[model samples]
Structures are given as structure tokens and as C-alpha cells.
Target: MATNDKQPVDPVVRARRQRIRRKRARQSVVFGVLIAAMALAALGAVAIYNGAVSMPFARGFSSTVIPADDPIVPACLVEGKEKPIGYKKVRVRVYNASERRGLAATTAKSLEERGFTILATGNVKTGVQNAKIAYGAKGVGRAYTLAAQIPGVVLQYDARTNAQIDLTVGQGFDGLIPEDEVKLETGVPMNNLPGCQPLAELTPAPAPASAAPTEDATASS
Candidate 1:
């Protein structure tokens, strides 16, 4: 009986109400899609930050490689008269080959005082009667430069590929020759040793300061 007073709903109003419902459903679907998209974006950012994913463009870049030592023959090897290579240019690593304690360090200090570039100080198993100046073909002049300092020093050539000279202290090593007694001719070109090898035929040592860890002969811990 109460329902008899109510009018029938308008068709246009019904259609509008249906359209509103459809719009709300579409909005809900769009919001859910947006949330999913945001979550995926966040995951992608995390992956990039963690280095799990890399940008395609970034693969084009790379780190620079250090160039090898230049193939240069010592001037003394090529020319009969060569300008003296200063102690500063000559690199030396001292090794104690005898029972003398701290001999390498003491000898390095002495050489350093005379403006020599002492790379390191350590010990070697090989024994010598007097100090032995070991050198590679690239360090012939450098070896001679060190030989000028130590009295009764002997030269021993090796297959090293660097210009670094090794000064091995021996049992008979007293000290560096007196500064006054060390006579280097002034304004005179240094003469090459007799029967010197062709520097062009030998491999060059690593550049200064780029010596490998395996090449190092550091003091025993």
C-alpha cells in the first residue's frame, strides 16, 4: 500500500546513475594500474642503484689503460760519448746479500744523501764478495752511475726489463767512497763500457713508479 505512492524512476536519471557507476569503476582500475606502475618503477630504480641492472648507454665507457714504457736506448749505449745521467734520473733498489744487518737501508740512505732515487731496500739470497751492481740492458748508464759511488763495485747484468738498478751489499762492503775521492769529470761526456750490448735488442723495463709488486724486493716483515 505505501509503495503505490512512489513514482517510477526516470529513464534518463537511471542511465546517468549507471554512467556514474561505470566511471567510478574505471577510476578504481586506473588508480590500481598507477600504483602497480609506481611499484615497478621503484623496483627498477633499486635494481639500477644496486648495479643489478646497467643502462645500455653506460656500456660504451671504460677505464683508461696505462701505456707501457717507451723503447729507448741509453745514450751511452749508442754514442761513444754520452751526457752523464744524473743520480736523480737513476733509480736504485738496495739489497743486502750478506749477513750485515740493515745494510740495504744504510746503503740506500747513503745513496739518497747523494741525490740518488732509492726505490726500495730489502735482502737477497745471493752472496757477493763486494757490492754487486745488477742492471738490465736499459739501465747500463744508471748502473755505471751507481758504480761510480761504491768502491770495488762489480757489475752483473740480468734479464730484467726495467731501467732500475739493484745495488746488492756484500761482506766486504765498507761504505760509499769518500765524496772528494769520487771523481766525475765535469763538462765531459760519459764513455760506454767495453763490449756493451746493443740496447735496441733488449726489452725495456717498466717505467719509473709503475714497477709491479712481483718486481718489488721489500724488506722482510
Candidate 2:
């Protein structure tokens, strides 16, 4: 009689097979998580390229603290001539045909409050009834000279007319000419006038003295 030959089924071998299957399932879960992370990164990149998401970044078109339209007032009228005076300083030149006199002082307090300084004054003995006025700084002498050349704007004094000429410099000069006339010259240079003195250094007023202590109060103390 031939007994049926059969292979023995070991319990230890079956347990090892079950552990291997569980490890493969865990590996599959880890790989799926890695693939999901990569897809999310790609989606973010595509959204940025399509303008679906806004990235806040700095640009050159931003506004600044200082405005571009602001006006600048010069510190000194002429170089080497920065002298402070009371509000409204002007140079006055009084001329009586052949004889000329120059005086610089505070003409109008209102004008001084408005940031206007008189740099120089000249008196020419022409026969016209109205006096000629010229306004200029150290760098813009030619502009003032060109303005003086204009007819009617600069008048000659006449002896026959009993009227006196009153010429003023400052804000009035700015309005008499075009805006381009007030600019500095590029080609021809300007020569500063000689014997020019600062308004503060010319002649100053005396300062007041402090009040003296009372004799009665001193004795009581």
C-alpha cells in the first residue's frame, strides 16, 4: 500500500508571509503621501504663473515722502552775502541826475514775512520819470540784465516830469518777466557787482540793556 506523500505546512512559515504583506501595504501608503505632496507643489507654481494668486512685491512706482512739486527757496541771494535782516529787506537807490545814493534796509515787513530779501540797489540818472528796477542773484545777473533791456518795463527818468520814480525789487520782478527769464545762463557768464555788502553787516542797531536790580529790594534781602 502506497501512502499519500504530502508536504508539511509550517505555522511559522505562514506567519512570516503575513508580516511581509503588511509591510508592503505600509510602503504603498507612504508612496501615495509623497505623490500627493508633489502634486500640490506643482499646482501652486501653475497658479502663480496664471495670475490666480497675487505676490506682494516692491515696485519702482511707489510714492516718496518728499514731493516732486515742492518749490525751493534759496538760502542766500548772492554768494558770500548771507545776512539776515528783519522781514522785508530791500536795496534802495535814489538818483537825482548825475548824483546817486544807495541804501539797503527793511522796506516792507509784509514782504519780509513772505521770504523776500533785497540783494542790491542801483540808481541810474536817466531822464525818464519812472525808475528802472533789476532783480538778480549771484548766478543770474544776465537774467536781470536782459529783463532791464525790455522796453516800458525799464523806463528812463525825465527831468521835465515832476513825478518821482519808485523802483522795487523782489516778488514784483518775478511777475514782470517770463518764468524762463529767471533761470541761470548756460553760455554767457555773469559778473557780480563790486562793493556789495550784506544787509546784516552794513549797519546794525544798538541792543537794549538789561534792567538794573531795585535798591529797596536789595536792602530788604
Point to the candidate with the largest lDDT: 1
* Range of the 10 consecutive residues with the lowest summed lDDT in candidate 2: 212-221
What does candidate 2's lDDT look like per residue over 1-221, in tens digits? Answer: 99979888799998899999999999999999999999997997888789897656735574533212112121123454323332223332222221212211222222233434433233333343322332222222322333232223342222212111234332112223332453334343434334444333333223112112112211211
lDDT, residue 1, model 1: 44
Best by TM-score: 1
lDDT of 2: 0.35
Q: What TM-score does structure 1 among the candidates reach?
A: 0.54
Cα-based TM-score, every candidate: 0.54, 0.26
lDDT, each prediction: 0.71, 0.35
Q: Per-residue CA lDDT of candidate 1, range 32-98, in tens? A: 9999999999998999999999856675454643232222233234455555578898998887766
